[model samples]
Target: MGEVVFWTIIRTAIVLPLLWVLKSYLNVDLWWTVSIISVYGVIIHPAVIHYRLFNEKNEEIIEDTLCSTCEHFDKTAVLCLKHDEHPTRDYLPCDGIDWSPKSSDKSQNVFDE
Candidate 1:
């Protein structure tokens, strides 16, 4: 996720200046069209693709692993917050000794009710 955002920022940093330079050469209507297309093609599209790939690669670790249900697990980063380590399907940072179940919103709501 951080990698996706980092690369998107890098692409924006690169593309924006080029678009600014092109604005001076092209007419208003053409520049608007080109800028929109360029922004989507260069920045948005690649970011979406990279995010999808990142999710695909981490799907198992995020969904099926024991760490996924732990209170310290961060689904977005697939990291154990307590241990400050990334967990894989085969590896756990705390080795189950420190594992704790994630608190459920539904259970909280029921108790409140």
Candidate 2:
């Protein structure tokens, strides 16, 4: 996720200045169309593709691990907040000794009543 965001920032930084330089040469209507297409093609599309790939690569770790249900787990980074380590299918940062349910789960039980 961070990688996706970082590269998108890099692409935007590069594309915006180039677009500004092209503005003077192209007619207003043509420039607008080009800007829209370039922004989508260069910036948005690649980000979406990279994000999907990231998710696909991390799918098992995200969905099947004990960290998925733990309070210290950070799904966005797939990190264990308490141990400051990444969790995998066969490995747990705390080895189940320090595991705790997410607060949202408790909240849901209360809300149901």
Candidate 3:
């Protein structure tokens, strides 16, 4: 997720200035359309694609691993927040010893209370 967001920011940084430069040559109306499409195509679409690809690649870990149900598991980044590490289908950062839920953790105590 961070990688996806990082690259999207990079794409925006590259595209926005380039589009601003295009404003001088293109008419205002066409420039806006081009800018919109370019932003969507270069930044939004690629981010979406990257996210889908990341999800597809990590589907097994995200869905089947013990970390998947842990509180520290970050589904978007497939990371274990407790140890600040990425967990895989075959490995865990703390070997499940440090696994815990997020701070919002209302579900953690559902049965406890």
Candidate 4:
């Protein structure tokens, strides 16, 4: 996910300046159409593809692992926040001993009450 976002930012950085430069040479109607198409093809399409690939590659860790339900799990980065390590199906950063449930406002309220 981070990779997808980072690359999308790179593409946007490159595409926006080029589009700005081209606007001077093209007519309004033509430039608007081209800009929209180029933004989608160069920036949006690639980001979508990368995001899909990221999800495919991490599907197991995301869906089947204990870390997926843990409070320290970071689904976007596939990282364990507590151990600062990536979790896989066979390996857990803290070996289950440190696993904790996700904290929610409801749970906190119960404890507070």
Candidate 5:
């Protein structure tokens, strides 16, 4: 997720300045058309593609792993927030011992009591 965002920012940074430079050379009508197309093709399209690929790559760990349902798990990053580690399908950072169910009501852990 962060990688997707980072690269998107990088692409935007590169594209925006180039577009600004091109604006001075091209007429208003042509610049507007080219700017829209270039923004979509160079910035928006790549970001969307990279985001889809990132989701596809992490889909297994996000859906099939025990960490998916744990409070400490971060689905976007596929990370164990408590342990500050990335969890894989076959590996857990806490080894299930520190696993806590995700609840909207601020559920308490047994150890917290």
Candidate 6:
């Protein structure tokens, strides 16, 4: 996830200057249209695909592993906050000793309710 955000920033950093340079040559309306499409095609699309791939790769770990249910588990990063370790389908930071329910139904979900 961090990598996705990192690369998105990198892409934005690259494309933004090119968009500026293109603006000097193209008509304003067409430049804006092209800028939007180029940003989406080059930056947003890859980040989204990378995110999907990252999610797909971690699917089993997220859904089946003991860390998946643990309070210390961070599903976004697949990390154990207390142990500062990444949990996988086969490896648990606490070896199941620290497993607990992830209370998404608590305060964070209050707005939804």
lDDT of each: 0.92, 0.91, 0.88, 0.92, 0.90, 0.88
**Taking the tens digit of each residue's C-alpha lDDT, what string does model 1 give over 34-79?**
9999999999999999999999999999999888878899988778
| Residue 104 of model 2, lDDT score | 92
Flag the better candidate by TM-score, 2 or 6: 2
Instruction: Identify the superior model by TM-score, candidate 2 or candidate 4.
Output: 2
lDDT of 4 at 4: 91
Best-first order by lDDT: 1, 4, 2, 5, 6, 3
Instruction: Return the top candidate by lDDT.
Output: 1
> Best candidate per TM-score, number?
1
> In model 2, which runs have C-alpha deviations exceeding 4 angstroms?
108-113
Off by over 4 Å in 4: 104-113
Clashes in model 5: which pairs?
none
Model 2: per-residue Cα lDDT over 1-113, one tens digit each: 78899999999999999999999999999999999999999999999999999889888988887888889988888889999988888899799999888899878878999
Q: Across residues 1-113, which tens digit of lDDT does each residue of candidate 5 receive?
A: 99889988998999899999999999999999999998999989999999899889989999888898888999998899999999998899999999878884245554466
Q: State model 6's lDDT.
A: 0.88
lDDT, model 5:
0.90
Segments in model 5 whose C-alpha atoms lie over 4 Å from true places: 104-113
Off by over 4 Å in 3: 100-113
Model 3: per-residue Cα lDDT over 1-113, one tens digit each: 78999999999999999999999999999999999999999999999999999989999998888888787888888988788888887789898798666555656578578
Q: How high is the lDDT of residue 26 in model 5?
A: 98
Candidate 6, residues 1-113, lDDT tens digits: the string is 88999999999999999999999999999999999999999999999999999999999988888787778888899899989999877788788888766787355667667
Clashes of each: 0, 0, 2, 0, 0, 0
TM-score of every model versus the real structure: 0.91, 0.89, 0.83, 0.87, 0.89, 0.86
